[model samples]
Target: MPKGEKVKAILFDANGMDREIAPLADVAHIPDKQIYWLIVSGQGAGKLPHPADGIDRAALRRGGVVVSDDRFCFSVPVAPNEGGHSEDAMILVVGRNWLVTCSDAPLSLTERYLEHDTGETLKGSLTAPALAVSLLLAHFDEFHTHLSAIEEKLDALDEQVFRSRQRHDPLNTLAVLRRRAARLRGLVAQHRSTIAALDRPDFGPAVCEEDRHHLTHLAGAYHRLVDTIDRTRDAVLSSYDLYATRVAQNTNRLLQRLTVITVGIGLIGALAGIFGMNFELALFKGEAPAFLMVVAGMAAIATVTLFMATRRS
Candidate 1:
């Protein structure tokens, strides 16, 4: 392989053979059975690749029956009021010289695996695609670790959701958490692609049946974790709705009291106006006993308002 090109398996002997390529080609030919694995990780998994190839990338994303992109592979976590990237996923798997790398992060995830200056093993033996699957799986493993961590945090959140309210603005917190859960679902869903790779045309010798099974098992584990997150999210949403209802009820009750008070005051002012007019007949009005009458009317109105306020409570 050329120096600048990325290769999970390389065969650079005077014999001119890389294990997997040799089986399929004359130059860079390699033994039929040597296994190799490689892995790399970073952020922006959307750009990451297995064997750094498009087809393999598709395979690694095999099981889409459940999860989605935002949840499983890429995540951005931050408060609504804060600014930051939320997407973070790490997982890659490799065995027997196969490569499985997961990381869309802009940096080279395979750098560490390639750190060893010289090893015949580093020369490469597995098919490009198979190596890609294996390495991609390794990346998924890292992703699983990250998800596990998230799960722990969510578990704690679940407890708190019940122990104390989500704060003065529960809806916003619920929205943020709901967004996080959605991202998780997308990330976990990609394992479906990983599972599908088991039957792809390029199953390199490095990717053993056992390894494939392990990948499937990992996918299942992620499914369970996602389910839990979803359930928790539902609870949070319900709690948010409940809180909103209570607030609305309290507001309505307040408005009702204020409405009755205003009407009572209005009626008192009208009655005082009528009594003071006296029809110009001086019906105890000439001395402006009107002031006393007004005071009495206001007091009566106040009493009525007070009675209503008290009775409701």
Candidate 2:
């Protein structure tokens, strides 16, 4: 252990009974062959016995940095906050009679679960698999709430996109939404794979039928969540496309206006050049009518150019 750090071990059974085993040494002397939750946080991992039969100390201590061996079926823990932002990674190692959770810091899930004192609330205590399932369900709740918020943002963005008067750029909003959707999808994929591995028969201890049923339901919920994310991504892309088309149309109109202005300015410049010449042209021969005629001709040419441009636009 890191200096004075101590690992917390909680022994529980299906009758909603819990007993705290003092210190790490008591783990080997438990009277019954029941499940215990060994929480090793901070440097507590240093105290764990290495390659102790069912427990792989090296894999557990890694804290989800590099993936553990596939044969061990360890899950890369993802802790999500109330806002659905993932906090940090941890590792879960489930065995036949013991469950080990390792992390660099204390986990919010453990704190919340402990604070609620959920032991006696249940008519019967939860099995190890059941406990794992509950933890996953908690994480998914946060994920679901986060997705709902994203969905709401998407709705607002959709309104802004469809309403032609809203001049603000939706591209930035779309880009942000796309990034969020992608990140959520990746997390969900990891979660899905972990759950799927747990559901398999050979991966871990044999879970009760009830636990299997719960896992099945959780898997279905995960699938639905992923589908929602996919749809959100598509919506963001569509909004981007609409925004691009609107920008293109605006650009075309702007170019048309600029072209008309350029033609008018070019005609004025040509007339000015002609009158500015040292050679005495008839149009500039000190006749007021001639000057007036030239001005009228320039005005007519400019008006015609503008008219044609406007008609085409």
- TM-score of candidate 2 on Cα atoms, chains taken together: 0.63
Candidate 2 has an lDDT of 0.64
What is the Cα-based lDDT of residue 41 in candidate 1? 42
| Stretches of model 2 off by over 4 angstroms after superposition | 1-38, 46-54, 60-73, 80-88, 93-100, 112-120, 144-183, 201-205, 259-286, 289-313
Q: What are the lDDT scores of the predictions, listed in order? A: 0.47, 0.64
Instruction: Give per-residue CA lDDT, model 1, range 261-290, as digits (tens).
Output: 888888887877876663665546545675
Cand. 1 Cα-lDDT: 0.47
**Candidate number of the best lDDT:** 2
User: What lDDT score is found at residue 285 in candidate 1?
Assistant: 53
